[model samples]
Target: MTFKYDVIVVGAGHAGCEAACAAANLGSKTLLITMDMNKIAQMSCNPAIGGIAKGQIVREIDALGGNTGIVTDKTAIQFRMLNRSKGPAMWSPRAQSDREKFIHTWREIIENTDNLYLWQDSVKELVIKNNTVTGVLTNMDVQFSAKSVVITSGTFMNGLIHIGKTQLRGGRISEPASYGITEQLSELGITVGRMKTGTPVRIDGRSVHFELMAEQLGENDFHKFSYLDFEPRKLKQQSCWATYTNEEVHRILRQGLPDSPLFNGQIKSIGPRYCPSIETKIVTFPDKTEHQLFLEPEGETTREFYLNGFSSSLPLEIQLNALQKIPAFKDIQIYRPGYAIEYDYFDPTQLLHNLETKKIKNLFFAGQVNGTTGYEEAAGQGIIAGINAHINCHGGNPFILARNEAYIGVLIDDLVTKGVDEPYRMFTSRAEYRILLRQDDADMRLTEKSYNLGLASTQRHSLLIEKKEHINHLIEFAKNYSVKPQYINSGLEQLGTSPLKQGIKLIDLILRPQLSISKIAELIPALHKEIDKIKNRKDEIIEATEIRIKYEGYIDREKMIADKISRLENIRIKGKFDYNSIKQLSTEARQKLDKIDPETIAQAARIPGISPSDINILLVLSGR
Candidate 1:
């Protein structure tokens, strides 16, 4: 059997979903091939999305005309703004979702989208002709023809799940692992490596002792991930609880180390460093007598609960023994044992910034295939691949985002430039300009670009412009309006802040840590009247304006640094440059530079082996 398409996207995971949406929405006839239709956009790990830097990426995806944010807003059972006490850059939005609803939402959107088709099958190999992907051959021996191909296989390629002494050939818990593709790609000169990641066991909520744990509730006023100003679907708000595992739990886990896959020679791959398993925590941090754990609800209807921090691959009995020791789980019953999965990933350096492979024209790799861990990282790359694939099919230049502009940009640059020694996860610390690439302003920064690519609609562009105008007007209003000392001195004194003896601009009052823009708007008549003009959108407007007022200096300084870096980025290096001829460059830098084939001087500087002196050598040698 054979079918034709403008673009063929393999895998229906988060990355694959976004990739298909992006391509199809851009007027390409796109086909989404997956192992199981029901598993499309499945959250195999935790039934939640967004946190810290990941939240910012979701906002970017929404701004770029993707569906992750909208689906999240429609299905979230609980929502929280993380790091609110910190700077605006660090304030990220996260939500607990209904897993079934998230998957269904994505599928409905894709199904209704024009120029998109879905096929349930596993791709066994690609049909390449003259150094370019023409299509793929599925396990059932069906051929799909395409001008461009995107593979976002996630963890299914030669995946192996470990549970103590037992090993299973599965991508997720019950989902079968994919085969043949890894072997085929290796023959095509794509280097492959292994990465390990795991999830904690799901527990029956009936077994949980909520009284023993500390309740963590969502805010009274809620927020959604989508930028469109509308009411989100209101699900019954749920609360998660935090608990701790004491020395007793640690002792039981340590006893099982002899049979542990992570500790023993059974599993050789490195797991995510930031989200280590319970066994790893016990072994690595011997001094700490306890570890914090969060009990997250899987869905409002189901009794299933996910243990947030107790990931393990110990023997089943040992896991039970350890959990029994924790006070909150004294009478707990495990629905399943935690397991670690190892899967194959290609070295992302072999790909261009648009995620298209350098070796194979019209072929792209995103998500876990690109060695990134989080759903956001995967979706970010997926969108880029989809956009680039569409451009390649119709004849246009590839779209790439600069690092200082968005967290998605930082993610792609880190992948294609630095590559991955381990599973890469995004953090606010990774971005140099987190202040500008904030969750609140993602649409302002990148929606226009996406609109040009035919991803974001005219309404999206208009919405973005209006939001910016409101924020700008609010900021100007605050700066221009002055508050009388007689009207504000009492309020200032009550806040324990120094009382003003003279009249001051409302913006000055906003600068005080003790007073916020909302409070100032309430205290001053003129400011309040001005704010009411955008009353329905006042909260967002005030938040955006306040951030600009609070961190104008730091944000400006970062911009200058970014501008200097952009100059280095503008210095292009030829694709086939001979680094070996530059004798002044270090041997390690020379070898690394030649391997990566960085397109810019700034990208060359980011490689682990490349140094400032080597960068200067490239600059002087290239006569930039």
Candidate 2:
């Protein structure tokens, strides 16, 4: 009655895709089970990927040999480097993808990958024996056996959709709700809660009044997501529009408040804090007269556009009435009304740093099912879970990433340590060593580690080695070369900086905030000649060398601090500790410790109610 696999990955969304790819790529016989094969890797909401800290996670996934960055680059219609004016640590690469093509690209890669298989079915229950998961039971009464299982159910578990006063059982707009698994998991004593997220309505692109909106064009220069040297196919780029909702639009939305699931108490789940619904925005930002809305094309060939900031669960007519008041959408014809979905999510604190369940051996969870809220976040967890599942199946050490190592590390640590009361989204401020975890350096950070783990490919490692050599050579060249005083004064004077009175090393000149390697090339004939040699990789080499020179002090300082705190992380707190029996710990610490079972002393220190005194007591007790 059972078929076999080394790993069984449930759900074929971003998280599931990466997990299956990672496991399969690592030589595990993996089976990817999904509700609909046609919907694999579908962008359930916006048709874009990466932003701010989110972009760093995607690149980290790519560095670790995951398919997201490769798929994104291949299907990208528009690419932009966000926060370029800021420091290199803040610069993130974002791409507007052809949603249809993104999925197709992911599916093709998976199909061609070694040791991976696809099954179309809903997983209803886990085949459990003792305290570990042996496999999953599908809706068709088919049992598939695996040594380890990873569930990346996303928002499809026990999903409920809300449209004003009308409600329906659905995962997405037209997709049916998935059931049985949540109830079954709860029966196994997993702590579960409801989390809500919503999407904006789609409009016929031809119906939009484009003349009234601000045209946000793509940058002329493109930066790709993958560290691989392959060139992605160039697609004709489309422009996105920016518009705002005024007081009039707010008034119209307010009128529909009574019917809103967000306001009418129809949905009690906590929605994403950063990406609030339009209805919530109206009430939360009452004094603000307007809110920005981005109109993004859903696909390269499709005429439908997603109204980015206008997510609402009000009645269909209410959404239409409100849209009609906006200047650009006065005659907007909606393809669908925005709706809120409430789905079951497990508290991520129940998971280990490797994403395996603490309660169930050989079982892991990722993505929205773990209360995270972005595609990049999900993909990051997916690859980690997949790697650990495969390692566990083969009786190897678990793979883990620490906070200072990568953005993916920060995400997993935050979720498992602090847990989420509301849907968690990544922000640059959340990372303490952001200076060390720059998106530009993701390959240098994780590719070797992934390669050692058998997750990253040899070609990825070779490319990384070549890139680092170029960067090092350029850095050494800049440090040794001297710039003539007269060579940079003209450029310096224009930037309002004092002209150089004496010759200085090129690295020193490049370190000045007002001067850049590329800018100085316009003045110094020698520098220009040297830059031309970098050729196709000139911009990338310059960026890497500049950041290393400018941020050397900050990066080293963070590394020292990270090294100190890493000692605390190294001191593990036993999960089986009977916190209740520890009288020296405070009442609140005892309760929190017992509940979270913090994996390390550093993680224990981060809990809300736990204090320095509590950590001191734990250190004394654990003999650290």
Candidate 3:
């Protein structure tokens, strides 16, 4: 029997889960198909979520009514705000989650979401008609019809696992590789490429000598990934341990290099440059004497620990020997050896910014299947794909994010515009408007947008408005409140800042590099009274206020620049001209323009090899 739905999402990893949820929540009848129900939204690589720019992506996803941030906050066993010493734009929230609980939590949510249904099956083929995807064909011979199909196949498509000279056909350690889909898409004239990524070994925490390693503790602050406040972390917090590989450890790894699959001419796919395997690290940075590794807890109750920076694909014995050389790991015992996996990915340039495939109508791709490496990156793309798929089915404009608006925008724009030569990872440096994309204000930037699209709930929009009112009130108070030298002079001296020479506006004191809103509140009773008015979300309000007051100039400057550049974005170019026939354009420009078919002049400018002269020519042709 054939089942029908408004949307069908293939694979239940981070991307698939978000895509299915977004579509269903937007009133579409959606089905989420996965190889195994128990492993929905599995943290296949790191047990943690969010880091650097990835944390920003998670917040944007949350603001846009996605479940990843909520799930992350609920299951978090340890939470830390990274790069606190730097500017607020650099600050990112990262959490180590209860792995088993994370999966269970996601399963519960997916099961309960309105209009969403889950099927335990592997999709082997797409049921397409006239370049439009109608549904999927499962390996069990069941055909499911859908108006739109989102394929978030992750690392499962034609996956090959490598460890030393040993190779296996699997998506993950014990999971079987998915077949047929990649070949079918390739036969349909879609461009397919290979990418490689690796995970580190799981260690027995009981065998670890924690005393020999430096302990890194988690902070119990008000900060979390989700904007909506939840009850404080319920799981018992755990500390991660840091250790380093010594000369001896490096020696052992070097001795096994010949047997490593990464080096033995076995794996040819390009891997993530930023998150290279342990073997690659040693070879690339040979002059270095040591490399630091973090031992993180896999769950609250489990004794399993994951080695953060020690990814490898060496022989099992070689991996064990290399770790055993480190003092904390002198008697190391691993649950399994780390292995590198290569999988098939479609060229992301074949996708629209909304994640819809350029070749197939109503077909979308996200996550590793689109050449991205992180779970956060995958989820960000998933939410957009889900939103656009719903729009494609119903009557609405396709959803797209601009680079100046979000890190998710930057990620999608980069993927579809430039394409990926290796596994793409998110970094703060990747975003040109990161100042406008801080973790503290994702809700400010995206909640209303999602709410307008009927994705974010009314409650979320109300919360965002409330938070903004509180922040604006606080900023107004700081601007008007005056502080006398007597009131803050002595306190300023104690804090190592120069004493105030005369009375000043509280905002002036707040602008001081050494003074914070919290510190000012401690010094001035009137300011403190005004701050107390915001009792509902005191810390969040104060932090957001501080960022606004402190970086007002920078924020305004970036917005002005973003607005100026956005003018080019308003120029429509897609299907506007036959670029190949435009003899005035360079050969390379003609080919790239005709290939990418950029939607706007701004997007065309961002495309590699497209020069200023080409853009001017296009502008002239368009009578700009």
Q: Please list the residue runs of candidate 3 whose C-alpha ends up more than 4 Å from where it truly belongs after superposition.
A: none
- What does candidate 1's lDDT look like per residue over 12-59, in tens digits? 999999999999999999999999999999998888889999999999
Error of 2 at 244 (Å): 1.5
Q: RMSD, each candidate, Å?
A: 1.3, 1.7, 1.1
Between the candidate structures 1 and 2, which one is better when assessed by TM-score? Answer: 1
Local distance difference test scores for all models: 0.90, 0.89, 0.93
Please give the RMSD of candidate 3 to the true structure: 1.1
lDDT of 3: 0.93
Model 1: residues >4 Å from true position, as ranges?
Answer: none
| lDDT (10s digit) by residue, model 3, range 1-624 | 999999999999999999999999999999999999989999998999998999999999999999999999999999999999999999999999999899999999999999999999899999989999999999899999999999999999999999888899999889988999999999999999999999998999989999999999999989989887557898899999999998898999999999988888899999999998888999999999999999999999999999999999999999999999999999888899999999999999999999999999999998999999999999999999999999999978889999998999999999999999998999999999989999999999999999999999999998889899999988888889888998679899987799988898889989989888888778788878888887566898889999999999999999999999999999998998999899999999999999999999999999999999999999999899
Q: What value does the lDDT take at residue 109 in candidate 2?
A: 92
lDDT, model 1: 0.90
Q: Which candidate number maximizes lDDT?
A: 3
> Which ranges in model 2 have alpha carbons more than 4 Å from their true place?
229-233, 486-497, 525-536
